[model samples]
Target: MLDVLSEGFKEAKLKLKGKAVLNESNVKEAIDAIRKSLLEADVEYSVTKNFLQRVQEKALGQEVALRAGKGDSRVAVSPADHFVMICKEELEQLMGPVNAELNMAVNRPTTIMMVGLQGSGKTTSTGKLAKYLVNKDKKKPLLVAADIYRPAAVQQLKVLGERIGVPVFHKEGADPVTICKEALQKAFDLGCDVVLFDTAGRLTIDSALMQELADIQSATKPDNVLLVCDAMMGQDAVTTAKSFDERLSLSGVIMTKLDGDARGGAALSIKEVTGKPIKFLGMGEDLDRLEEFRPEGLASRILGLGDIVGLMQDFQKVAEEDQEAQALKLLQGQFSYIDFYKQIEMIQKMGSLKDLIAKMPMQDMIPKGANIDDRELTKVKAMIDSMTKRERIGQDNLDRPRMARIARGSGRPVKEVEELHKRFTAMRKMMGMLGKNMGGLLGKIPGMGTLGQMNNMRKAASQMGQMPGGLGGMGDMGSMFGDSASKPKPAFDREKQKKMRKAAKDARKRNRK
Candidate 1:
């Protein structure tokens, strides 16, 4: 997501590579690239300056040189890698430690007060947090619609409550403070362990708005006061966090719209500038897309190292609770179109493919021009729906005629249907290979890498066409995603291809003439 920020660190790594050791001149050259990137990303100047200083200080320190060519992990660390390690450690330090999760109370009915500027996604984040509590934390949560100032804010919260199966507490013609106080009683009646107050936001922070929030906070005495800042707000998000922290003494921050925020200055800046932990990151508009903020994973992603742990967590969220048994069954070779359909659903629920790929170290293994389309799942589903019951259950494997029928029924090309079937066949074999080793992988997510499962994945990927960096190239990802990367392509002879195409076009023109 932070492409610009990543490019900076990548450039710095290139600058330091093949060097005997870190030196002030080379380090400064690398830092200059990083400095330009940070400023371009809209990071706060002070935070950027301080972060670079910490990174540079450690990079040139004696420990880095001593540890050069050695690593705590299995792999050896080169000078360039050691330098990047310094940068990564410093970046993680700057972002602060992981919040673990929302700070809940020992007693029942933990109150979480959500505050932010208007249009900052306070209400949506409240619903997402409630969904997180329900799905991940397995606790009863009540959504409090205390944003009475904005028109339809209560109704909006009600819709979200219905969507997430959480109860909404709102009073007609009641003030925000009163609504919050009464919502506590409702939570008590409902036996909800968590109560989230989606407090009213303002176009701009003002005395009257802050006073209203202060009144609610004073009355309810929330256990957590989270300020939801829009990531796209950049430095202004930092400013908003500052203002809110000063007024309400915020417990933590929730950064929203990170999926759309390419620069990611706010996410990197808010924690350092405001001295608050980023508890969760709001990735997309989906209620289930709120991710717990892990500084280590984020720092890795920002430096283009990829966050395998985070990627596993995303997979765990989608598959652990509802689809664990199903996923395991499919992995055990009982897979069919019915199960493949569910796989597509799980992938869709896991959010965007591009974002998922961004969290993988093998992201570059994808073909350079490959386009990972989320809508491809819908198309695959359409094709599956066109098949008969026997075909779906894998009792009657599809022949060419059957595939043609499905293509016509689904309004797709026959080649696409054929490709789907081929990819599905390949995946069925791969899953059969992985069935034994990956039995409990879904349940052990976020730590699956440490559980000796990455090797299992590599083995599974090898059962199909192996890619350079593992994960079975685009063929396996193609099997999962049904994207253009379903087949690995040879590196092109660009000039040869260009000349051939030009000659063909000229011959066609001559024939026409």
Candidate 2:
């Protein structure tokens, strides 16, 4: 989402490389790069200025630390790292020191009022929020359709509520304020713990709409009044947030459409302008795509360092149990085409492959001009599906005739099928080697216990290895780690080492002859 900002940070880091300290003379170009990046990302001018000012003040005065090198390679903390650290800290501070938690009423139903401008994704966000509450917080949320002015708004809310398995409360032809007030009572009667009132919005801020929202607010007395702003709206979203906060005194903000080609300026600007914390982010159209806003996570992402914790959270939501089992199978070299297909399914459940890769820490390692097409996964699945049960379970079962038959069934070339089989076999072999080495390392560690007994720890390591490229270029994990594991290794035994050295010397002498 903040691709521009990420690129900017990368350029800034490059400019600071080889420098010893973040002095004013050396950091000016880096600061300029950051300033340009923030502006290009559509960040509010004043906010960008203040953010850069803080980064400069802190970076220019910070002391650079140096440490001992490994194998004669110097390991000093470069100016780039120091400057980047300062920027990361400042960005985190700018977005948040505190995450705005939902303040639900203890004794009674907590009414949440959703307000925003037209086309800002208020209705969609309302559905997403309802799903989040029900699934994450275990709250019986009653979705109230009070956007009576918009055509089919009520119907849309109903459809969304149905999709998420949440109930919707809508009174036909009733005023929004009245509908909201009645919805509150309905929630109480239905034993719903939360009532989300989706209030109507306008094309632009008008007194009539603001007054109507104010009346609804006065009637419903919502526990939380959240303004849903479009991240793609940039500074306009910030201005809208300020106006809404001034009129309705919003408790928090929800930035929507963050998964789109948004510059991400609104998310960085709204909180600073309106003095309201962003509580949730609408990442996608899926009812389950709303995520709690974490400043540190977003800041880390903006700086090109992938959000590993956020990635794990996504994983936990989809296949936590299956992942554990799969990791064991992978470690034991027991995974087959069936297991590979299941892993692909698990990845699909997590989200888009591109989005998943963006969360990884090694974006630069991605080959230039290379695109990660999720369609590739679907194609691979199709090829696997064409195979017979025995062939899928046993690689040796895929003879020439069987490969040709499978290729015809999958609408692919026989060569492609053969390539897939080769890649799959290589991946299995590499994973087996990695698992054995890791297991041996663990077995040697004092008090760590046997590798077999440490299944949980092994699974955790396997999960880390299961990144984009780990499954033999399935994602992009292969690009980061390469095929180094598959290369032949020198013998570690002293006698074997001596023999290898003598053989190498003899080979050189033979070449000279």
Candidate 2, residues 464-495, lDDT tens digits: the string is 44333322353234433343442335657998
User: Which residue pairs come into collision in candidate 2?
Assistant: 468-476, 468-477, 469-477, 469-478
For candidate 1, write residues 369-484 as lDDT tens digits: 45666676788889999999999988887999999999999999888787677666666766765665554566764343434655666655554443222122235555444345
User: Which run of 10 residues does model 1 get worst, by summed lDDT?
Assistant: 465-474
Candidate 1: regions farther than 4 A off: 63-74, 101-103, 106-108, 320-334, 366-370, 429-513
The C-alpha stretches of model 2 lying farther than 4 A from their native spots are 68-75, 320-322, 437-440, 445-472, 475-513
Provide the TM-score for each candidate, comma-separated.
0.81, 0.85
Residue 300 lDDT in model 1? 90
lDDT of 1 at 160: 97
